[model samples]
Target: MEDKFIYTDKERKLSYQILDELKDTLDKSFLENDLPMLQVQLKDSVAKNTIHRNVFGLNPILCSLQTAAIAVKDIGLKRDSVIAILLHQSVQDGYITLEDIDNRFGKSVAKIIHGLIRIQTLYQKNPIIESENFRNLLLSFAEDMRVILIMIADRVNLMRQIRDAEDKEAQHKVAEEASYLYAPLAHKLGLYQLKRELEDLSLKYLEHDAYYLIKDKLNATKASRDAYINQFIAPVRERLTAGGLRFHIKGRTKSIHSIWQKMKKQKCGFEGIYDLFAIRIILDAPLEKEKIQCWQAYSIVTDMYQPNPKRLRDWLSVPKSNGYECLHITVLGPEKKWVEVQIRTERMDEIAEHGLAAHWRYKGIKEEGGLDDWLASIRAALEAGDNLEVMDQFKSDLYEKEIYVFTPKGDLLKFPKGATILDFAYHIHSKVGNQCVGGKINAKNVSLRTELHSGDTVEILTSATQKPKAEWLKIVKSSRAKAKIRLALKETQIKDGLYAKELLERRFKNKKIEIEESTMGHLLRKLGFKEVSEFYKQVADEKLDPNYIIEEYQKVYNHDHNLNQPKETESAENFEFENPTNEFLKKNDDVLVIDKNLKGLDFSLAKCCHPIYGDPVFGFVTVNGGIKIHRTDCPNAPEMRKRFGYRIVKARWSGKGSSQYAITLRVIGNDDIGIVSNITNVISKDEKIVMRSINIDSHDGLFSGNLVVLLDDNSKLNMLIKKLRTVKGVKQVTRI
Candidate 1:
C-alpha cells in the first residue's frame, strides 16, 4: 500500500453537494473570501460525528455547526467567527484534540474552541456551580470576544432544534437555562433580534399554555392589525416623501414572549395590551443630518396621528448605555388602538439588530471595546471571590436595571436601583465610604441611607472618626460596599486582638509566669473562641473576667503536674495577693477587705451609687480594676450578691477622708440660648469642681442633655443641683 489518506466509510455518506449551496449563500454574505478553507474544516469536523448522537438523537455537532455558521454569516460576522463556530464542538467532544485543532486551523480558531472546551469542562467537573456562574465563566474567557460570539450562536442553534428533543426534563432544563442565562447574555451584548428569538423559543417550552395562547392571539389578529398598520403609515410616508427625506417604513408586531411579559407585568389580559405593534422608520441620511431628519420625521408622524406624550421614548436624544438609538412614540391609530412609531437612521438600525457584533462589523476590527471593558469589570469581581455576595453582584450587573446619577461636579455615575448613598460613596472610592458620615443631595442635607434616583446631585460628607459598622452591611445594596465593610471590620478585629494579647501578657507578667502559644491555644479551646480578635474583644469589653482567666490558668498549668483534668476542689487560698495591695487593711480597721488577703488595693466609689462617708456600703473586686464601693442598699446590690458572693467584701462607710467622685447628671428644661453657658458658669464658681463632657439635644422648645462632672461629696452634689435648678430655663436635674 502506498502512503495515502483513507476516508472512513461513514465519512463518505456526508453530502458535499449541500456545502456547495452553503458556499453560494456565504458568497451573498461578506464571508465569500474565506469560504474555501472554512468549508474544508467543517467537512472534517462533521465527519467525526458519524457515531455520535445528541440528546435529541441526531448529529448535534453537525447540526450545531451548520446552524451556527448560518447564524454568524447572517449577522455579518467575519470568517474567523464562522470557522470557530464550525469547530466549537470538535475538541470538546473528542472528535479532534486541542493540539490537532491548533495544527490544522491556526491559533485563533484553536483559542476560541479551547475557550468553549474549558467552559464545558468546568461545568462538567463542578455541576454544583450555578447557571449564573457558568454564564460569568464564559464571559471571563471572552478576552478574544470571538468565543462569546460563537457561544451565542451555539445557543441560538440549540434553541432552534430544541423542539426535536424527546426528553421533557432535558428539554425543560435547556429552556430554563436559555431563558435565564443565554437570553440575558444576548440582551447585554445588544443582540436584540437573537435575544427575542431565544426568549420566545424558551418560553414556548417552559410556559406552553401561555406561549400557545399568545401565538394564537397573534395569528387571529394578524389580518386586522396589518390593515390598521397600513392605514397608519400611509399618510406619514407621503408626508416624509414630500419633505425631501429618504426613508424605509415597515411595521412590526411584538414577539409572543414580549407580549406575554407585558400582560403578566401589567396584570392585564391580551385585550388590554396596547402598543403591541410598532411602525419603524429607518432614514437614509448622512451622519451630520441624522438628528435633524429624525426629529422632522417625528413631527410628521405625530401630525398624522395623535401621540401620547407619556409614551414617548427619545433614545436618539441620549442613546441607551448599550448604544441603542431611536425615537419611539405611541400614537392613536385606527379604531383608537395605540401603535408605536420608531425613528432611527440606517447605522442605528444595524447597531440595534447586531449590538456588540455591529461595532465589529462597521469598524472592521477584531474586538469590541465597550464589551471588553464590561467583561473586564465582571472578571475583576469574580476573581475577587466565589461566594454568594460576588455571584449576586455579577448577576445584578448583568440583569439589573441601571439609573444614572450626577455628582456635585456634574459627572454622571450609573448604579442599580435601590442602591443607597453609601453604595454610591463606596463606588467612588473606598476611603470616601470609610469616612462618610452623611451628606447633602442637591444642597439639601440627607442621611447616608437615602436611596439614589436618576439626575440627583450627590455630595458625600465625611468624618475622620466615622468607621465602618457591622450593621452597615445590611444597609448597603452594592457588593463593593459590602466587601469593603467586611475588610474594614476584619482589620478592626485584628487590631483588637493585638490589644487583647498585650493585656493578657501584662497580667501574666504581674504573676511572674511565662506565656506560651500552647497555653493560649488551650485557653481559647476551653472557652470555645474561634478567632483571637473575638476573644480579645470580650476581655476588653468587660464581658469576660480576668480573675476567672487567671484562676483557670493556675488550675490548668501551675498546679501539680496533671494537665488533663481541672482541679475541681481548689480552695480560695490558692489565689494570693501582694503586700502593696493588702497593707492598707491594717492601717484602717474600718475599711472592708474583699477575698480576705485582697487588702489595701486601689478602690473607688461606684458612680451608680456615689455613697456618702456615713452610708452603709460593700466592695466589689472587679477583674483587673481593684475595687468599687457600692451602697449596701444599692439597686444592683441584690444581683451582685446573688451572682458572685466571693467577689463581694463586707464594708461600712467611714467619715474620714475628702474625695471627689465623677457623676453623670441628666438635665431637662425649656430651650434657651444661654442655658448651657449659665449651667457651666454655676459649676465654675466651685473651686473643687472639674467639668467633663456635655451633650445636648433640643427639640420643640424643650431641651434635654447629659453632663459629666466631679463633685467632692454628696453634700456638694446636692448643693450644685440646687444651684442648677435655679438657672434660667432649667427645669429638672438628677444624678444618673
Candidate 2:
C-alpha cells in the first residue's frame, strides 16, 4: 500500500528461498556466458541486483528488472556489468552511494553509475542539456558505451512501467516523457518495438478521447477484423510456403495517436485513412538473401494485389544512419482496402525491438561502448552557465532537432534545429562565425541567418575585416552564433567604452589638465557619482556625456546662468525682426573649436542670404559638436535645422565682411478635400532656393510643402518667408 513499495505476489517471492531461486537464474546465465575471470564475481552482481530491488516499490518496475536481467545476461555481459544495469537507478532513488558502488562493484562500474547520475541530473530539470553538453556526452561514450546502454535500459524500463501507473498526473508525465524523449531515442537506437509501444502507450494517456475512439471503433469490428486478416493473409502464406521460402507474416495497425495525426494533418476521418494496417514479413534467410527474397515476395504480393508503386520503400539497400533497415510496400487488399507491408530479416526484427541495445547484444553482448564522449560537449555547455544566449544555445542546439548538413569538403556537420548559415559558420570555426558577413546557400548568395535544411551544401562566405552586426541576432538561430554574437557585442561595447574614455582624457590632456585621482574625485563627487573612476568608466563604456562633463568644468570657472531660450520677434506694421539671443554669441575669427558659445563656435547670419534674426540656425563646431551655421528658416533645415533649433543662436552682422548661412522656407495650404494641389501653385510660381527632403502626410483638407534657401542675414531672412502665409488657400508659413 505504501508508495515506496510495490506489494505484489512477486514482491513476496523475495524470501531467501526465492532469492536462491533468482540466484539460480543468475548462476545459470553465468555458466552459459560471462568471462572465466568474471564467474568469480557472480555473487557481487546478484547482491547489487537484490539491493536495487528495494529502491522502487513499483511491481512493474521489479518485473522490468527481471526482464532486463534476461536481456543483459542474454547479451553475455559480465557479472559486474550486469550489476551496474540492475543498480542503475540506485543513485536516482537515493538507495546507495557512488562510493559504495566504487567500493563494492569496482571503479569501472562506479564511473558508469557516475555518468548515469549526470544523465539523471540532466533529466531532473526541464532543460535538455545544450548541444555542447550533448556533443561532449556523446564523445565521452566513445570510450565506453555501457554507460550509454545502461542509461538507455533504465529509460526503456521506465517507459515499460508507464501504463501501470495509478496516478493520472504521474502517468501523463511518464507517457509524455516517453513520447518526447524516450521514443525518439529508441528510434535513434533502431529499437522499433520500444518506440512503437512507447508512442502507443503515450498516446493513450496524452490523447484519451482519440485513444478510446480508435479502440472502440476497432473493437466494434473484431469479427470483421479477423475475417479481413484471414482473407488477406491466406494467399500470401500459401504462396510463400509453396515457393519454399520460410517467412512469418502478421498484420499490424498503427496506434491511435498515429491515426489521429493523419486525421489532423489530412483533415479527414478515420475511415478515410488508407493503409492503416501494416503486414509484417519476417525472413529467416541470411542478411543478403533476406533482401533479394523479400523483393521476390514483394513481386508475388504485387501480383496478387494492386500494388501502389509510390508506396514502396527500400531501406535495406541503404540503411538509416541509426541502423534501421526494411522493405516496405503498400497494396490494395480485399474490400478495396489499402494495406502496407514491411519486410525484414529476423535479426532486423530483433534490432527493431531492441534498437542499439539489441544490436549491441547481437554484437556478442559482453561489453558496451560508453556514451560519456557524446555527453562531453553537453558538460562543456553546462560549465558555460545560464547566460541567456548560452542557455538558449544549449536548449536549442543540444535538445531541439538534429540536422546533418555537409561542408564543401564532404564532412557532415550536425546542427541544431533551425540552424542558419551563420550557425554553420560558427560551428566550423569561431573565426568563420565572426568574419562571416554573409554566405551562399546551395551556391546562391543568402543572408547569414538563413536556416539550413538537411543535406544542404552550405558554402560560407568570409572576410577578415567583416564583423558581426547587432542585427545579426534577429536571424541567426544556432546557440553557438547567439552566444558568439553576444560575446562579440560585449567586446564591441568594451571597445566603444575605451574609445570614449580615451577621447575624453586626450582632450583634457591637450588643455594642460592632468586627469589625476583627486581632481576626478572632486568632479565626480560634486556630480553625485559614487566613484571617480566610474566617470572615466562611463566615458569608456560610451555612456557618459563628454560635452556635459567638459561644460561642467567650464561652468565652474565661468559661472554663467543664461540658458538659450528661443523667442520669435516681429511687428505687423514695421515687420522688423529682433534678435533675443545671448549677447556673448561667439566670433568666428578662429575655426570652430570647443568655445564659450553654446553652439560650440562663433556663428553669425551672412548678408548674402540675409538670414533674419528670428530664423532657426544650426552650429556645427569644428571640434566635438562643432559649429557650421544653418538657418532654421530653411525648408531643408526643418527636421535637423529645426531639430537642433534650440542649439540655434541669434547673431548680428557685427562682422566686418559679408557672410551667408543656409536656411529654408515653407508654403502651407489646404489639399482640396475632393482632390487638388492647393499648395503646389505657390511653390511652382516662386521657386526660391535649394530643396532637401519632402515628406507628405495627407488627410482631409490639409496640404503643406516646404522650400529651402540660402540666407545672408537672420533679420531679413525671417521677414521674407513670413509673407508667404498670406497666399490664397495657404493657411500659414513660418521660417521653420
Candidate 3:
C-alpha cells in the first residue's frame, strides 16, 4: 500500500494524544512497538480508499480511536479488544486479511477482528435490526463475549457523536436501535453507567420533548433535591463512620429515560414521582469482609430510617447472574419521602459499573459459566423459529428482573420475575413440566399458573395421565417452558396424525378400496386441509370421523375414476330427524336464502359450530344432496374449504325469523357461592332467551360449565354472554 493519504498537523497531534491516553491504560510494549506499525498500515489502507466515514459522517480513524477509548475507559477492555476495534475496518474492506492480522497481532486479536467483520457484513446486508440478523448478531457475540462489550462501546461512541449529524432520519434510526438493542445489552452486561448514558442519549434523540421535560425538571429541582439528599445522608454517614465502616456515599439522580418510564407507568408528572434519586454507599473492603460489611451498613440504614420491608433487595447474599452484588433498600428519609439506598463493596461496584469485563477480571476468563448459560438460552430461544417469540425472549431475557426461589431439597433456583410454576417445572425437566398437574408452595397447593416469589419452596406435583395442552402456553412465562410445551404438543400431534393416517388406511383396506394419493390429496384439499398431517390430526382428535372421511374419499375416488356406480345403501340411523320439513322454514321463506336465491332446498344448521341468525354463515353440501349451514369460523370450516371447495355455497340470513337457535356458552370461574344461580339469573332475566340445560363441573377451587341456551339471534347470545361475564367470580365466558 502506498502512503498517499496525508494527515493535517492538527489531526496528527490529536491522534498522538489518543494514542498516549490508550498507552496509559494498555501495555507499554504494545504501544511502543505494535501500535505505530498498525497505525501506519491503517493510514496506508485509508489512502488506498479502503476506509470511509460511517453513516453519521464520522471519520473512521478518529471514530475507531474514540470507540477503543470507550472500551478501555468505560468497559475495562484490554489490548486485544482495542486492537480488533481499530483494525476491523481494514479487514472488512479487504485491505488487510485475517491471516495477516493473525501473524502480526496474535490469534486472539485476529479472531475478534474476524467477529467484528462478520457483524459489519451482516449490517451491510441489512442495516435494520431484523430477527434473522439479530440472531446472527447474538451468535457472533456468543462466540466471544468481548465482541459484545466492544460493540456496546462502539454503539455508545456512535450515539455520542451522532447528535450533531445532518441526517435526522439516520439519527432517529440509530437512536431507536440504541434503545431497542444496545441499551438492553448494556443492562444485561451490568454496565449501569454506560447503560444509563445510552438510554438518556437515546431518549434525547427519540422522544425529544419528553426527555427535555424530565431533564429540565431535574435541573430546576437540583438545589432542593441536593439539600434533601444531604440532610438525609448526614445522619446515616455519621452513624456508619462511628460504626467503623470505611465507606463513601454519593447521591445519584435517576436517568431521564427512567423518570420518563416512571411517569408513563404511574401516569403521573415529574413532581408526583418520589425516590427520584438513589444513595450509593460504596465500601472499601476486602473480598472476605464484603458481605458482612454490606449487611452491617444495610442494618445501620434501616435502623436509622424506617425501611419499607417490601422494597428491600438483598443481592449481596446471592449476587445477580451478571455479577452484580449489592444490598438495596427504600426507606423514609428527611421529609418522610422514600429514598433508595445501595450498599456494595468497591469490587462489586466496579463489576456493576463495567459489567462482564470487570467480572472476568475478578473470576478469570475460564470461569465465565454464566455467560455460557445465557448463550445457551439464546440458542434455545432461536430454535423456536418464530421471529416475534424469539425477539420477545431476547428482550425479556435482557431486561426482566430475576426472582430467586427454592426447591424441596433446599436447592436455590432463579427465574424471571413473572415465572410461573410451570416455568419451574419445565426448568426442572421437560417431562416434569409436561406432567406437572400443580405444585405445593410452602406446603400449600397452588395452580401451575401461579407466579413464584422469592423464598418460596416449591414441590411440583405430577400425574401420569397429565399431558401438555395448548392452553399451557399462556400459563408459563419462561421461553424454555413455552418452547418445550410447543415441541411436546407438536410431537403429540405428529404421533396422533400418524395413527390417524394408519386408521384411515385400514378403513380403506377393509372396504376393499385401493387408496390413490392424488385422489386422497384432492379429497383433503376439498376438506379444507392444506397439509395431510393436519387432516390426519383432525381425524385423530375426532373432530372429523374416520368413517366420514372414508365416505368422502369413496365419493371423490369414484368421481375421479369416472365410475357410474349406483349410490351406496343409505344408513337411516345417520339422520337426526327423518322429516326434512321444518315449521319455521314453511312459515317464512325470506328468513333464509341459499346461493343465488335457491329456494325449497333441504337444509339444516350444522351440529358442529351451530349457525344462528346474524352469524356469519356458509353452506356445505353434505354426503347427501342437502346443504348444511355452518358458521364461517367453524372448527371444520378450514378442512371443508381445503377438501370440498366446490361443495361450499355462500349463504346469508335475510330476515328476522321467529325461530330460536340453540347455542352453547362455556363459563369458567372460581367455585364460589351462588355462582350457578348468578349465571342462571342472567339468562332467566333475558325475556326472549331460554335456558335448555346447564352442565357444571367443579374441581380444585375452580368451576367450569357449559350453558346451552335458545335464542332468536346472535345479538341476544352475545348480550347473554356479556351479562354472564359480569357475574361474581366469573373469570371467563366464551361461546362453544
Candidate closest to the true structure, highest lDDT: 3
Against the reference, the lDDT scores of all candidates come to 0.72, 0.59, 0.80
Q: Model 2, 406-501: lDDT tens per residue?
A: 566545567666888888888888788889977886678997768886546689889989977778887777777789888987786677657776
For residues 1-736, write the lDDT of model 3, one tens digit per residue. 5334455687668777998899877764364558777778877876676676667767788888899999888876677778888888888777888999888887878878876765554444343452332533454333555677788999999999898889999999889888877887788767889999999999999899999999899999999999999999999999999999998999999889999999999999999999899999999998888888998998899899999999999887666766677899999988789999999999988878876556544652221344445643543443453211232225323223565566776555667778999999999999999999999987899999999865567899999999899999988888888999999999998899889888888988998888898899899889998887788888888899878888898889879888756777989875222122756565653366678557557888899898888899989888889999999999999999999999999888775555777888999999998999988888888779999999999999999989999988888878888888899899999898
Ordered list by TM-score, greatest first: 1, 3, 2
TM-score of every candidate: 0.53, 0.47, 0.52
* lDDT per residue (tens digit) for residues 143-192 in model 1: 44455666667778788877867898988988877788778888877789
Q: Pick the candidate with the highest TM-score.
A: 1
Ranking by lDDT: 3, 1, 2
Q: How many clashing pairs in candidate 2?
A: 67
Candidate 1 matches the true fold with a TM-score of 0.53
lDDT of 1 at 178: 78
How far residue 351's Cα lies from its native spot in candidate 2, in Å, is 2.5
